[model samples]
Target: MERGLTGRYEVTRTAEEAVRAFVPNPLPPEPPLDLSGERQRLLEQALLACGRLDGVSALLPDPDLFLYAYVRREAVLSSQIEGTQSSLSDLLLFELDEAPGVPFDDVVEVSNYVAALEHGMNRLREGFPISNRLLREMHEKLLARGRGVDKLPGEFRQTQNWIGGTRPGNAHYVPPPPADLADCMASLERFIHSDPKPFPDLINAALTHVQFETIHPFLDGNGRVGRLLIALMLHDAKVLRQPLLYLSLYFKQHRAEYYRLLDRVRQEGDWEAWLEFFLEGVTQTAGGAVETAHRLLALFQEDRNRLQDLGRSAANTLRIFNALCSRPIATIRDLEATTGVSYPTASKAIETLSELGIVRELTGRQRDRVYAYDRYLALLNEGTEPL
Candidate 1:
């Protein structure tokens, strides 16, 4: 066994030992990857479900609206894993104006994290190769604002890190020592950019995720970082046009099972079962996202038609409505910034929308009042229920 230290904590490991030695047994059954005949049919059905989500997402009046919503959802989910109580609505409402007790700076950091992920996704869409540098950049964006003291933002671990538990003293698994960090990172880089072997992209994603988790490269934010890698890798592999499939909800819901399955792979080389769980997560999460997108689109179209019937100014109404779609909460300042209108014009647009019942005032304060795209936030929140 190899022994090392991170500060005062001790980490011990061996090359041939179980990947997660502290995790117990009774691993789940391995799943099969051969999607021939009936299996192939199931795979097609899952892809079709994902396609429907993309179609519905395309119906948004402004694609940036959906993109913004996605960023909030990603932040909320990533925060949840770390025991942060922020919700999808919290993120949306905070964007309009800072909330009491909630750190505005942290919110900005989270927004940038989401933006970095979106930027990475865009690069991947344009066929850019995934690199260690890209992952570090994303991590830096994610941890830009220090969450608390002693946790440096955006920097990698100078000491060793572990998984399966919170503190090093209580960790269930200690990965390769710092002396082996180079080999561990090289393995991860190979997994990311290397040619695909016999495994399907989804299966490969699950394996890569486990490997990254095992590596535990960062001091904090490993869980969130690992999840982000899943979305990016899937986009890079062309499995989805957008980084829309978020499995954190799935992982959080089945926390024990998730960890168990991951440990099973390292202990028993049980790739099949992990692949099945991942594929199932994709199918279910994709379906939920599709439903949510459809509902949001329907709501948008209905509201647009309503405004048109009222003989509203098409250009201004469309601009305000589109801004609300992207950001569920908005202020006159936001409307002015988005629509490039005078403050008075922006106020008039918001008042008109409020009168039309398309937007509702969230806060009663006269100055810097917040307006909510209730329907849009509802649809986005529907898919994200805390476990």
Candidate 2:
């Protein structure tokens, strides 16, 4: 609708020079959003896809098994957008604590993402509201160790920050000045907790995402935390039963368009365009998650059937295989502890699976041998290649 510039810009001074920093208005865009016709159809499709994704838990023995791997996949992709080179295998290998020569800084950032995500979901599960306090908590965990440790992890920035250039004067975008950050975020919190919200939860989420990004609340880890906020918002609103919908892969795929729409919302008041893109991403990502679940279920069934064809040793072999499904990468010691089998039994079972081409040894060592559920990791690793 080209209502106008979404917010006012103020000339703020950086160390080098002066720049125009943006202060975005709160949620529920003025003159309202135009969700008629095509936008409405997109919204319905997105909600239906979300419903299907929520029901995918029915296909799994335990949803946490999928979530355990899926969340790490998300962490990898999200950190990649921030220029991290960590892959899914790197993350799994790190979690296994056998990371000898891995990319420590990149993998550390990705690992912190997993921890931050888990913290938010756990708090939500414990009936905590989605508020600034929760955002700060997640940010604290996000920068707990690696790269951005000195940037004040849990607190909002008290210094002006700019994006995409060498200095604020030449930066492509400048967020609100430090003095206005608190008011901007407080307005965002009110919109989140508002009863009888002005828009549907899906639309509300899309709007909140843009607002949060524009605010650039944290000095570092703003991009990662903003992505996490989407999953957190939808789950808290009861829009999804689980935190299964992630847009990191989608945003990473259509990154140029994602940035363009964010700019349009700020420059021309084009909320409709951004809503359509965000809604399409929700539908596409949710559908992909459900499809992945089905494929994993089928893979387990097919492999188990193959094991059943064997004779007396099938019982114990199947036991270790079940444990492998939960932790696709593990040491024989890990498999032994998880399945309560002897070291010899665990070794023998893994050897049997290796003969069947189901498991591959990661480290060719006499001791501390690690095995991978080859096909399973391949399935989860799709679209997670680091940029």
- The most accurate candidate by lDDT is 2
Please report, as a residue range, the 10-residue window in candidate 1 with the lowest summed lDDT. 1-10
Q: What clash count does candidate 2 reach?
A: 0
- Cα RMSD (Å) between model 2 and the true structure? 1.0
lDDT of 2 by residue, 1-387 (tens): 787899999997788687999999777798888889999999999999999998986557988899998999999999999999988888888898878345799999999999999999999999989999999999999999989899999999999998999889999999999999999999999998888888889998899999999999999999899999999999888888778889999999999999999999999999999999999999999999999999999999999999997798899899999999999999999999999999999899999999999999988888898899999999999998877
- Tell me the tens digit of each residue's lDDT in model 1 across 309-337: 54556668777887777677878888898
Per-model C-alpha lDDT, please? 0.68, 0.92
Candidate 2: where is the Cα deviation over 4 Å? none
Q: All candidates' TM-scores?
A: 0.82, 0.98
Question: In model 1, where do residues sit more than 4 Å from their true spots?
Answer: 1-44, 58-61, 100-109, 122-128, 148-155, 164-169, 312-315, 383-387
